[model samples]
Target: MSKVVFITGASSGIGKSIGLYLHGKNYKVYGTSRNPSKVNVPFSMVALDVTQKESIKRAIGEVIGIEGKIDVLINNAGKGITGPIEDTPTEEMKFNFDTNFFGVIDVIKEVLPSMRLEKSGLIINTTSIAGYMGLPFRGVYSASKGALELVTEALSMEVKSFGVRVVNVAPGDFATNIAAGRYHTPVFENSAYKEKYAENLALMDSHVSSGEDPMMMAKAIYEIIKSKSPKIHYKVGGFMEKFSIILKRVLPDKIYEKLLMNHYKL
Candidate 1:
């Protein structure tokens, strides 16, 4: 039987790339979007809002009703935020977690029973390289993805006996519309972080604009799906981007902080 794959946030960007690529490979692919009718794609795009629990339930139920089981679940639906921790609204960070962290968990919970029943499943979480460190002006975004990474670790072991595998795929940066959709706290003229926040905001967007192709991530996902024993974490990105994770492990804490500060020109 062709494997059934369900992905969230498939309306655009990396999620869309994964869906289309998997569809071309003859896998049964179903993706999610808040407004399915707004976009057109070769694979199925169901109505889903990660922030809403009922929506997640309904979407997964729809897929399972037809396919009877999901072989792979890609948690790709997420939002981004950029600003100084102090300057950014607290509510904004909470909302970001609602989508990026909590929403992913809820979706996994909904799919786990079916996966466990079938005695096999793969869960690929879309995390970020930023999650490995607290970057300047992107602290909130970093925290959310970091939390998801930790949960993936915990869940992977917890579900091992059930034959359900959970892993994180952290991408450094990829050219996408995430920049335009990100919640950017304004650089208030009187705020202490005004100048630095504005400058870093632009830097964040530029990285996305010049980042690697989304198909790279899509290809990585496909490989993971086919693996017999996939690793706990898989990172996809440029040389420096993936190397940064290694540097974090070997470098002194203070030196690593300095390197990031210099890179961001802080």
Candidate 2:
């Protein structure tokens, strides 16, 4: 039997591309959205709001009923929040964490039992390069992804003995419909960072709009899935973005900060 793959946030963007690509590769792919009815993809669709525990359980149950076991689980559901950290409201930050961090945890908890029983599974998380370096106006979004990356790292060790592998795929800018889902925190008229926030937000959006094709990410994901033993982290994107990860690790603290400030024109 072919491997069964379940992916979240598949109504559009990178998740949708991954689903379609995997389907073409003969995997029995199951994709999820909060509202599956609106998803017109060729693979199976499940209604899953990753932030809701009941929704996660129901969706996983439906898949298990048909496939009996989930060979791969891709936690791709996430949202973006942009604003100066001080200006970002508490509720907005919570919402970002809800979707990007807690949501991933919810689905992983639901699917782990079956994976543990089988003594084998692959859990791939879609993190971001922004997670490594806190971008100027996207602090919360970066925090969310960074937290997920840490969780993925720790999970790899915790589940290793159970025969489950966890990996984080951190992508730089990618062309997707994420702009629509991104929430811009309200900037008060008297805020100190208002003007700089606006300029930085615009620059970030432009980078996303002109990002590399989503297919590159989808292809990278496929290779990881097909590997006999995949690494714990995979970085995918343009040269500078990929190199930034290495630079951040090796560069002096003040020098790296200067490079980041210069890149964002801060």
Candidate 3:
């Protein structure tokens, strides 16, 4: 039987691109979206809101029922929220975790039973370089991804003996819907962080607008899954992320912060 892969947030962006890439590679693909009507991908479509456990449960159940086996589970459904930490609402921060962190956990928990029963599977959590370096106004988004990065590391160890693998894909900056409403800072009222916000938003917007094609990320993900043993974490995208990673390691903290501020025109 052909192997099957289940992907969340497959309606568009990198998730959708990954689904298409894998499908074209001959894997039976199951794609999920909150609005199934908006998903026009050639793969199977099911309604799923990653923020809701029930939605994830139902979607996975459907995939298992039809495919009888899930060789891979890609937790690609996520969003971004950018603003001063103080200006970010309590509910907004919670919503970010609800969708980006806990949502992936819910899907993993729902799918793992079958994976363990079969004694094999691969899990991919789509994260960002933000997981490593917390951006100025992306506290919530970074925190959510940071949480996932920790989960990915610890869970990889936890599941290694079970013949299941957990990995994280941290893309630097890519053209995707993840930045649709969140990357840009809103004009704040009485906000003392306005200059910082403006500078960060401008940097984020420029990087996102000119970032690597989503296809590069999708292809990288495909290659990882095809490997006999995937790494615990892989960084995608290009030079910007690579440079950030190196700078975070070599530069003094104060110097790095200064460089980032100047580079972003803050």
> How do all models score by TM-score?
0.99, 0.98, 0.95
lDDT tens digits, residues 108-156, model 2? 9999999999999999999999899877888899999999999999999
lDDT tens per residue, model 3, 5-26: 9989899988899989999999
lDDT, candidate 1, 1-266, per-residue tens: 89999999999999999999999999999999999999799999899999898998899999999999999999999999999888889999999999999999999999999999999999999999999989999999999999999999999999999999999999999999999999999999999988878888888999999999999999999999999999999899999998999999999999999999999888
User: Candidate 1: how large is its RMSD?
Assistant: 0.6
Which of 1 and 2 is ahead in TM-score? Answer: 1
Ranking of candidates on TM-score, top first: 1, 2, 3
Better of 2 and 3 by TM-score: 2
* Least well predicted 10-residue stretch by lDDT in candidate 1: 193-202
Cα RMSDs, all models: 0.6, 0.9, 1.4
Task: State which candidate, 1 or 3, has the greater lDDT.
Answer: 1
Error in Å for residue 160 of model 1: 0.6
How many angstroms is residue 41 displaced in model 2 relative to the true structure, after the best TM-score fit?
Answer: 0.9
Give the winner by TM-score: 1
- Residue 5 of model 1: what lDDT? 97
Model 3, CA-based lDDT: 0.86
Error of 1 at 205 (Å): 0.4
Backbone atom clashes (below 3 Å) for every candidate: 0, 0, 0
- Quality of model 2 by C-alpha lDDT: 0.93
